[model samples]
Target: MKKILMSACFLGQKVRYDGQDSLLEHPLIQQWKEEGHIVPFCPEVAGGLPTPRHPAEITTRHPVMVVNLIGEDVTPQFLQGAELAVEKAKEVGACCALLKSRSPSCGNRETYNGNFDGTLVPGSGVTAAELQRHGIPVFNERELDQLVEFMTMQEADVA
Candidate 1:
């Protein structure tokens, strides 16, 4: 069975910056759980950030850096986590990841800006960017079914 990389928060884990999860309870995730094809991960946590971490956003720079509202640079940790997530995905031969939306580490599109203001910009997160660079398709909770369908197509191709 083809395994999928997943954001731990979506798996009902309290790994978010606020120590809470944005649970989607999507059926495809449940199905994947039943099949044991889910590889739950949190790039932010994996990068050494605390569970109740200071919320960070992508900085306005050439190579975006993750910074908290207090303007502390956490880019190395985010990059580390992203790289580790990629390694894990490769280790399990996962071709796709169901990531969190609007997260600094796992967002697939439109993450928060680094200004600490309530705003959004079009872009992928650190982990999402890494996964995409490695050719792993990344999806948010809203795209769970599409991910399932895409995975199904991949399986069919292998068959």
Candidate 2:
């Protein structure tokens, strides 16, 4: 069975910056849980950020700066977490990653624009980018079905 690297918050774990879980109660996730193919992780927490952490975002793309709402730079921690996440994915032989959207560490397609003004832009988060760079495909929660399709193709190739 191919394992999946998942964002902890999607597993109903309170690992989000606000100490909340972005629970995704989907049947496919339930199936993966039953199959023991879920490797739950939170890059922000893994990088040494605390629960109820100051919400952060990518303030710059060139140097990839992650700054909290209070203007503190947390880029190093985010980078550390991203590295850890990639390692974990490799360790578990994860076929893909299902991450939280709009998160500084987990977003696969888009993250907060770092202005703290409720804007969004096209981009991948730190962890997501790392995972991708290592050849692990990343998916947001909204793309579960798409992930399933990709997984099917992977299995097909193996078979």
Best by lDDT: 2
For all the candidates, what are their Cα RMSDs to the real structure?
1.1, 0.8
Superposed Cα RMSD, model 2: 0.8
Number of the top TM-score candidate: 2
Which segments of candidate 2 are over 4 A away from where they belong? none
Q: What are the models' TM-scores? A: 0.95, 0.97
Superposed model 1: Cα runs more than 4 Å off:
none
lDDT, residue 82, candidate 1: 96
Q: lDDT by residue for model 2 over 43-85, one digit each (tens)?
A: 9999999998989989998889999989999999999999999
Ten residues in sequence with the least summed lDDT for candidate 1: 60-69
**Where is model 2 poorest over a 10-residue stretch in terms of lDDT?**
139-148
**Which residue pairs collide in model 1, if any?**
none
